[model samples]
Target: MNDNNKDDKTLNHSRRQFFKISTALTAVALTPSYILKAADDNMDDKIAELFEKRDLNIEVNGIVHTLSIEPRVTLLDLLREQLKLTGSKKGCDHGQCGACTVHVNGQRVLSCLSLAIMQDGKKITTIEGLAKGDELHPMQAAFIKHDGFQCGYCTPGQIMSAVACVREGHANNEDEIRSYMAGNICRCGAYPNIVDAITEVKQKGGTI
Candidate 1:
């Protein structure tokens, strides 16, 4: 009777182990597809977010452009990277050197510090746009005449600020031009020539 009892107990334990193994195998086989589907869904969402772009419509150099840009992109990057307008140099990206200066709605601004999204429906003027088909703007002509640049890396920003200085009526004299154009740093020490360019433009009433 005791032997019969022991055999029955062993049979029950074997059945339990078999059922547990079968359940685990079923779960393992079925869970992979579900887990893979979940991972695929997550990857799709991440790809969509990574490629998200905002529509941008702004006039550049008298021509209007419709662009798709990321929110974190700066105007400088949009101009240089997307639009192929590289006249504006990326110097002192911190907005301290003023090398990324450009005109927004006729007001000089630091493009490196300005976001492209915020400039929708605005007029932007870079150094490339400062000239017509074959004629240069008065400011450009004056800079050339006065030899306002040395290495020319900072010339674009210097010219833009100089134009603004004249338009704002801040180019009355040497001191005023220096004070107003202080934001632009010409490492070549072309301060005197820059002042000369601005003063000439002011005296001649140069067209901005």
Candidate 2:
């Protein structure tokens, strides 16, 4: 009877060991599926990120640039952040102050209100691009001669708009210049000097 009891104990220990090994094997087999699913999820995220970015090619300051950017990026952000062209001010990003004015296809548009994706394959001109190698543009020179700015924060936008004003034949008289340039606000009250600068450029009638 002692030998039979010993045999029963051995059988129980063997059963316990067998169950432990079986459970470990099952867990090991299931872990690979979970890992594979996690890997697939990560791969899907990577694919989504890739799809969200788009290729953009634009010409700025007479130079062509190719960029990969998100669709929601603004033209001001693209110019200042990516291209390092910070001449355009960001005051009143809501398009009320006209501080971010720039030329698109020879027409003035608020850079903050414009999207970068919409400007793909289009021409853009900033204040930095307005000058030649060592000579400033005619409008810039006139602004310097007339002191059209006070703090100089709004000078870039002002100069850009002034150039457009002359090019579009809107600088005929003081009232017209004021009416056309009403979008640009000078907190320092430099309206008189700004008018003088635009008038000088228009009288000269040289290439703006």
Candidate 3:
């Protein structure tokens, strides 16, 4: 080939390579900035809005706690996230599952469905508050003795419901107990032991 033709081809190739490198470097430099901006936007949206944070005063496990909480925060989230009492599980945040069940003013309530603001001035009792100084309640002891749980994910709710069931006179018989506890589904299929635990607690005149 002629020298001039060869030189022209080399120049074109060099220009192509330079353009490719420049494009790639521009993309790489812009990627992190775009990602950072998206992350910042997400953080801003997640920041609890000023007006949403409202003052909350409630008695939890016999202790009165006062703090500001988001209006959208559920009672379960308030206990687990704000107060750091994680004994209540977050199964089925829509209240279909009873893992988040707790006692509100001595009544069994689905914490996941109840709002923190709605529970103001109410007494809240979680699994952590069920026992008294190394002494398990009769229902808890009965559950342990009867082996009422396998994975134990739903045990807290089951126990809590059992206590309330007895208190509400719903534990008249095995069928009654089972029917009343139907709301708290135990995935482990420990229904028999759960009934036995409830029966034992009832026989002992135990009240939660």
Candidate 4:
């Protein structure tokens, strides 16, 4: 080939290689910026949530407590996990079971379905709070007397609901007691005994 033709071929090859290298570098630079930005945004969101917690001030069973908890924390978790009040069982965390029943502002509340952060400045009563120091509440005593529980896993919630039933004036009769206490489910089938206990408590008529 002539020298002029050879020089022209070399120049064309060099130009092609330069464009290839520039395109590769540009893609590498541009692709990483988008990927890195997405990664950074995800990391920022996780970091923000990791330190996110709200202050909660509330009373439980006549004792006031100040706590800091995540907004997603449920009242049942706050009692069992944080405050160590495990009497309110965690059965059926979806609120189907009554094992997590407790009192919030004098009404029966399903703790598992309730958010602790939303209960700020509210009064909560767990099964552990039903008794006065070493003295069982009347409903607790009645439950024992009537053998209202067998496995006893559902007893705490049962007793709590029972107290609420009597206080709510729903225990006027056996049928009424059964109707109000229906929310509490005893796997051992202690409904009859539970009804008996609540009936006795209601009939006593002193202080529920």
Candidate 5:
């Protein structure tokens, strides 16, 4: 082939390859949308088939929460999604981190690990319910005063555990407080401040 003719042919091949790659990329991007739409449609049908309207009577904070919750809903999901109380965070859904800690019948329990049905007719106190009108709980106040949190992702759990620790008389000393709160991990390494908050609350005779 002539040199000019060969160069022209190479340019044409490159243009065709570029178009082919562009088309492939477009299809690849659309594939995820199509799959997501199909999955959403399937979920809608399953929800309609499985979900039955029923009343769920449970006490949240101090008031009775009467609403319908799916049988498969976890207590943590119910609290955050259904009730719109997102104070109890979902750190470790497997009950490892105490982020989803809340008072169930006056005892600290991992809300993520509990079923909504199991907490029926029991008193539930979330972090939102800890404060009284405008006054924060002693632990919450201590947390703020001592700057017990860095990222604040683990602060809620730390505060909740601190409340329980004091109420259960586990915060008799710094070492005991640390040992008791060892279950609730803080990625920010705010253990000293957390222990200080717990100690302050304990000194004041605070109860959850």
Candidate 6:
């Protein structure tokens, strides 16, 4: 009788082990298909995304550049990251501060808001391009002479907008200069000096 009892216990243990193994196999087989693909195929998708760039041809400062870049890349990133032009500041990248200002096709634009992919065959001018060899642009010289910048982080944008303001013939008076240059924000309260610089340049009346 004791032998039969021991045999019954052994049979029950074998059945339990079999059921546990079967349950585990069934669970694995029933896993969602998307989960399986995410574990293995998603990595390949990310790798492919890294190479997903389109051809871009644009001019910077004065030199033409042909590059392949992702469509999401902004003009500011293309200049600062790829072309190594760091003069354009990235303050308030929401197009409010105007720090990332640059000339796009002879018009002032916020680089942070402009996409690199859409600027094909366009001319872009940054703060670094505002000067000749060993000579400053008239606006730049006036800014220096009048002390237009205090912290200097907003200087580039200010100068770009100032040039545009003068070019647009909106720098006729102090009020108009302030109104036209209102897009740029200088934290150091250098408005008077900036107005002076723009006024001086406008009075000179030469090509900026």
What TM-score would you give candidate 2 relative to the actual structure?
A: 0.77
TM match of model 6 to true structure: 0.77
The alpha-carbon deviation from the true structure for residue 206 of candidate 5, after best TM-score superposition, in angstroms, is: 5.4
Better of 5 and 6 by lDDT: 6
| Stretch of 10 with least lDDT, candidate 4 | 42-51
Q: How many steric clashes between backbone atoms does each model show?
A: 0, 0, 0, 0, 0, 0
Superposition error at 199 for model 2 (Å): 0.4
Tell me the deviation in Å of residue 142 in model 4. Answer: 0.2
lDDT of 3 by residue, 22-140 (tens): 54354345555654454445532222132235667899999999776668889999999989998888888988889888999989999999999999889999988989989998899
lDDT of 2 by residue, 31-82 (tens): 5565445444544343333225566789999999978677889999999999
Compute the lDDT of residue 104 as modeled in candidate 6: 96
Query: After superposing candidate 1, which stretches have Cα over 4 Å from the reference?
Result: 1-51
Q: Name the regions of candidate 4 deviating beyond 4 angstroms.
A: 1-51
Compose the digit string of candidate 5's lDDT tens values, residues 99-118. 99888898888999898977
Query: Per-prediction RMSD in angstroms?
Result: 20.2, 20.0, 18.8, 19.7, 18.3, 19.0
lDDT of the candidates, in the order given: 0.84, 0.85, 0.82, 0.83, 0.79, 0.86
Q: State candidate 1's TM-score.
A: 0.76
Local accuracy of candidate 6 as per-residue lDDT tens digits, 70-95: 88899999999999999999998899
Q: Please give, for residues 54-170, the per-residue lDDT of candidate 1 as tens digits.
A: 667899999999776778899999999999999999998999999999999999999999999999999999999988889998989988998998899999999888888898999
TM-score of each: 0.76, 0.77, 0.75, 0.78, 0.73, 0.77
Model 5 residue 54 lDDT score = 38
* Descending-lDDT candidate ranking: 6, 2, 1, 4, 3, 5
Candidate 5 Cα outliers beyond 4 Å, as residue runs = 1-54, 206-208
Q: Whole-model lDDT, candidate 2?
A: 0.85
Error of 5 at 78 (Å): 0.3
Order of candidates by TM-score, top first? Answer: 4, 6, 2, 1, 3, 5
* Model 4 pairs whose backbones collide: none
